[model samples]
Target: MSQPADYRDPRSLRSRERIIRALRAELRAGRSLTIAAVTGEAKVTRQTFYNNFDSLEEAGWFALLEDFNTLLVDDIQTRWSGASPDFVGLASLRKIVELLRAESSLSLLANGYRDEAGLTGLAAVMLSEIRRFRAEFGDPASPLAQEEDLYTATGLCGLLTVAATGDASSTSIARAAYALLPEWMRQPRL
Candidate 1:
């Protein structure tokens, strides 16, 4: 008989969580984060850290993405529940920009990924959340069309790219995003 797929063990999960916690702690301490620093903080050997993650960059990206997703989703849902359907798109984008401003780690993660995987993943999550918000709105008059998705995704990708580059302050980015809100959503036709 074929063997069943092995699931992640509790210990492995615990170790990974510990590593993430340690990395965040180091970052919070205003210390330059390195693999050695994280391993030391986690009380794990370099080999163990490597065995769990291919590289510090990978771990950083995963941790930041996970954290931002949780925070962003919760904020979006709460805001959507209180706002009109017409407001969903801008509200969601504003929430994302706010998150990018508040969380410095997100910028780090975006900068860390040379490959498109991180950007693609971030875009996918944002797109999914926006779709959910639209569905919840249930406005046939303002349905989320393919073009809207494309525009929102591109705008978010641009924002993330700018944030990652660290060329401008998060406040400036947020303001720029807010300024573009009307054009981005541009209420769907009946």
Candidate 2:
């Protein structure tokens, strides 16, 4: 019989964590990412790195996705717990834009130059989170339903893209996202 995958193996977990930490450090330093840098930083051979991840982009993607999810959840809990109905949605939007702008790993992942597969995976996670939010809070029908979600996702993606290129201003990005709120939410309150 074939053996099941062993994600709990200490060596495997350590290797994965090392790779994630290396990627995070590289991104924070604003250094150009390469397989050589990752392997060297993680103290692993090229073959070892490849065994843990398909490519450098995949390594970066995993790190960024984890950071993004954690930050999103934490920011929501901290900033929106007792906010007024209208302010809640806008505050969430601003927080997202600000978070994306500040997180270099996310900015790198969303840039157009990264692996398309990784980018698509990140997009899927973002969409899933938004759906979960709607389900939990009640999805009041907005005239811009699909458009609003897509636009918000795309705008956040764009914000990260610009930040990766070193052209984004956090204040401006947050303002733009907040500005879209009135039209994105359902009228007559719910």
Candidate 3:
């Protein structure tokens, strides 16, 4: 029996890459992704899109997460290259909340309260990125290191959901969410 094609396959990777590029283009152009829009942007058939992603929302989630995190992580590194790792990550997260607030309409649409399925998908992506960042900065000896993945996923999801709701929260979200980080990961007073 032959192995099935996976994302690692060259052609499959190319197809997925085009689909993601198309998704990003639609979002950057401030267009909602109708099937036609995605297919047109990707220059691939509708069937190709479906083959790579289960739904349009899933594709959007992947594209959004990839673009957002790539920029955010780079910004964090540039701003705090000399600072301790945890400080940089914490600051970056606060910045993320601010950016989300600034892009209120887009954030609201992705929040998915009106569309429960979308909420789950977006939250999953958010949690995955946040948790990955946390682990990168996490203290190996801290209790947090041994906790289940749900610790960061559920906690950050809840925090971000709340942050998304407050219209006047850009400045305050940083300290609020930063306080939730494990004690060992926090920056000490000067």
Candidate 4:
């Protein structure tokens, strides 16, 4: 399974870490990401950055996804206990917002460069984890269940990108996301 970007050698790992840190700093400063700019900021050779990542966006997205896998996915899996779908969906959305807040650079990269940074790839990672969650904690997912999961995963990526870039508060974004949850997952009114 693809966890984080792991390296066998300490030197390579250190180089990659420096590159990611530099990417984050560039993003925080609202600088355009380019190989030359990143390498200069990282104080690494262009070849060193290339050895670690194909592009500046790739490095940013990879770091973001790694954190998502470690922080959100693991936490969700740990919390699963056949809870109602509404509970799971809302909790997951809230956690995503919290994750983005904690990692401002990742949020900026994801939001500012949504298409370039490959948010769809992030959604795919989320889908796989959602599939795993269903397999372990609930009944075998039906076609409808799978569809719901796909929508939830993709929708969140788009919604989160908007939340990061727009004026919407995180709580407001969460509320809107909750309201838009798949009907099947929503609780019935009293």
| Whole-model Cα lDDT of every candidate shown, in order | 0.59, 0.58, 0.61, 0.66
TM-score, ranked from best to worst = 3, 4, 2, 1
Which is the leading candidate under TM-score? 3
Per model, how many backbone clashes are there? 0, 0, 0, 0
Full-model lDDT, candidate 2:
0.58
Question: For residues 74-153, what per-residue lDDT tens digits would candidate 4 score against the true structure?
Answer: 54553554556566567666777777766766655543333432445556555655566556554444657777787887
- After superposition, the stretches of candidate 1 with alpha carbons farther than 4 Å from their true spots are 1-7, 79-82, 86-91, 115-154, 160-190
Could you give the C-alpha RMSD of every candidate to the true structure, in order shown? Answer: 6.2, 5.5, 5.3, 5.5
TM-score: the better of candidates 1 and 2: 2
Measured by TM-score, how close is model 3 to the native structure? Answer: 0.68
Please provide, for model 2 over 22-118, each residue's C-alpha lDDT reduced to its tens digit, 9 standing for 90 to 100.
8777777878878788778888778767767776656656665666667557645643555464455455555555656567564455342334333
- Candidate 3 Cα misplacement greater than 4 A, ranges: 1-4, 28-32, 71-81, 85-87, 102-119, 139-148, 187-190
Weakest 10 consecutive residues of candidate 4 by summed lDDT = 110-119
Tens digits of per-residue lDDT, candidate 1, 1-190, equal 1111322777666777788889888877878778899999999888767767766666766665676567557655655456553455445445556666565664555346433433444565555554554454424245556557546756766776566456665555655655554342434222
Q: Give the Å error, residue 69, model 2.
A: 1.0
Model 3 whole-model lDDT (C-alpha atoms): 0.61
Output the TM-score of candidate 4.
Answer: 0.63
The TM-score that candidate 1 achieves is: 0.60
